[model samples]
Target: MEFSELLEQAGGAGLFQTLLLLTFILPCFMISFHVLLENFSASVPGHRCWTQLLDNGSVVPANITPEALLTISIPPGPNWEPDQCRRFRQPQWQLVDPNATTSSWNEADTEPCVDGWVYDRSTFTSTIVMKWDLVCSSQGLKPLSQSIFMSGILVGSFIWGLLSHRLGRKPMLSWSCLQTAVAGTGTTFAPTLLIYCGLRFVTAFGIAGIFLSALGLMVEWTTTSRRAVTLTVLACSSSAGQAALGGVAFALRDWQTLQLAVSVPFFAIFLISWWLPESARWLIIKGKPDQALQELRKVARINGHKEAKNLTIEVLMSSMEEEVASAKEPQSGLDLFRVPMLRKRSCPALVTSFSLLISLYGLVFDLQSLGRDIFLLQVLFGAMDILGRATTVLLLSFLGRRTILAGFQVMAGLCILANTLVPPDLQTLRVVLAVLGKGCFGISLTCLTIYRAELFPTTVRLVVLFFLPETRGLPLPDTVQDLESQKSTAAQGNRQEAVAVESTWF
Candidate 1:
């Protein structure tokens, strides 16, 4: 019998697996909070030039309304509202007349706001835009900050991807969670935009590590029977976190407070990491049969499997002999490209992953363009994510992973592209398209997550690609051979027919 069969004898999907799943829920939710943090933290609010029209350098006056005072100091914008970036060179008292028309102000001389700008704080009491005066000419910094954070994630992916497999999953996860909590909360004290961007970059770096390490833990810990369901639950939890962020941001109303709120929980995740079980499969592959045996016995004890206590290291070692032999070869991320068969299969997945990320985040970060209440929009997008994942659960029963992945990606792209044809004035239609696009993207993401895990082995799965096999009810492939043999497994039985359809993408 294989190690997977032994795992079942030790009580598959029992108390041990249940506890492991519960441990991951918080980390998954907190990670989602950071993913959408900027939506509230860097939001741009309504604003106009701050021109002192009264004593005390105040725009508001006891004698005149703020709007009436703006008529004298500020110029009319394209929509007849106060110009946000520009103001009259001198007070134009004549424009205060009721007869003022577009022609009257069309030739008015105006200059950029030299002193500073005033913001409307009705929705958000404070944001990074308000803190740094990132308005008008400086407005570009808002997106740049998010871009910087993304670059950190990209850099960290390469670093953590290579290190986690070598060092171990739990340690990397704990360290990354601590790093994210520290850097994330540290953003509140940033005295300058540069410092804030630096802290956010570090925060994103830790986030990438956290995500990769957590994925490794999840894939290695669960049996095939629960893999898809487990992934769906995690995805749904992420959506719940995103939806919860809208409410949290609405209550906090300050960027500093919001940043701290989302970040501080990671500290708890770090503390909880000590209790998580190390992957026995990974231990055995690393030539630590004694440690693997101990971990397995612990699992069996927790799962109430008395027979497992009688098991010896020899039985454990023999069960994983194929995987242990495969691990003798040195491998790295480059191997994914160096191996012709691996390259042929991974390239499509790589392209699909890249395109999906671009489309999904492009839609996610552009929420303000929808012209609806931002809080409402955030919640709506999150709700659609939940709905999409729920839909994927049903579709997976009848559809191949490649078909679902490709189909959803195409549908999501169509929904987002279709939004371009809709007139801006039709706000409801545009929002509908955006929400549908998010839902499709969510389903695509869910499919991609499970599919990628199934395509590689435990050793290199963190870097890129997994075993080239379907993972519906089979054991995890700990080595390349373990994956290749799955092709024959699929052909051997009537129940395995669907596995062949799924693995054909390779």
Candidate 2:
């Protein structure tokens, strides 16, 4: 079937199915694309060809045996020829048959089906290509593409946060889910690298927006007691998504096939949107007290409380009188640092946000570059994340947020330092240290999310939380420059001190 027909079929499905699809499937597409982009060169044609060197240390035959392994040893004199040195050849292919007494090994250039094939010796300079390096070496454009995608996420978070607050969460989330799915699917057909990157950025933007809106909506709709658990659950879902990506990518195998498999869920999630009601708190904020009351009544009814017919705006107003009175005037992003009270709250929140971003992004990119064993690290991190989130949810009421956060940070820092010191021989210990670092980081990240949301007042809470990650980018631009400056200053100071000491001795 055609792409348009597939989309039409998905569109025909109800909102609940659509929401379910987006909530679960969209992540698979994002992860699968990331994996494929990193691995695609492995299967490309001409990637496995070998090169043979002639007498003068120059490449001669370009299409040598695919499985030939060449060892080069430089001759003592410049006048040396390829024929002057002895060459040793090894079998390039091996075959295993259950019925055979001994497995037949295909030797050198000889056909596997032919019997008694002899190995052909070649010059040491001849180089047989192994598997092509799957490392993403697209340099300028690829890194730029990745950065643009991340930038879109930053932009989308801000846009969606505002949109959710203004237009209502349900609409924003539903729209974001649909847009992300479309963008993700469109990426597979992108003719140029630039176009592919652009589509990826758009898809990432929509995903960020949808996630932010959904989280906010979930928090606002849940009771105070359930809010923390719900948020933790969401975090677990994200971690689960990451883990699921590994399996999904492995199963799909092919890039296009993986993309399609991942996208299938986005089309399914759209159906679940119908069941998601607008947030009562958000409705009240938007001057829809009647609708808010109706939603609240539904909640109360679900909790086995009779819907009070006499419940009025005044009663709700009386209940929230203290909160309403304490709701401060709106403030701009800059005002966070200007106001003393705001600064106190903002500093910790900013630190938390920065730490969380570094932990998450650092781990993500590290896993992307470090292949094969990446699955093992991801499993470790995912398990830690789930455990950490669950533990945070359990301890949030008992442990002071700042204490827990600080402890986690200290632990994470120590783990990192320890990782740097781990002996090369103690690989197992190194792995343990890495896992410990991830676990500590995961706990800190979960705590920061909850603490940052709680520190800001209701009016500015969402704004502050949404912008926290974006603000982290500002300091990073000058970070290296500032570090170099400090290093230079310190070195100069040390030289002056040394000169003074020498003068005193003289």
| Top-TM-score structure, candidate number | 1
**Candidate 1, overall lDDT?**
0.82
lDDT of each residue in 131-209, candidate 1, tens digit only: 9999999989989999999999999998998888787888898899999999998998999999999999999999999
The TM-score values for the models, in the order shown, are 0.92, 0.66
Choose the strongest candidate by lDDT.
1
Model 1 weakest lDDT span, ten residues long: 497-506
Backbone clash total for model 1 is 5
Q: Which stretches of candidate 2 lie over 4 Å from their true place?
A: 1-137, 140-142, 318-331, 368-371, 423-427, 464-506
lDDT of each: 0.82, 0.51
For model 2, how does the per-residue alpha-carbon lDDT over 354-388 read when each residue is reduced to its tens digit? 86676656655555333335445566666776677
- Model 2 vs. true fold: TM: 0.66
lDDT of 2 at 289: 68
What are the root-mean-square deviations of the candidates from the true structure over C-alphas?
3.8, 17.2
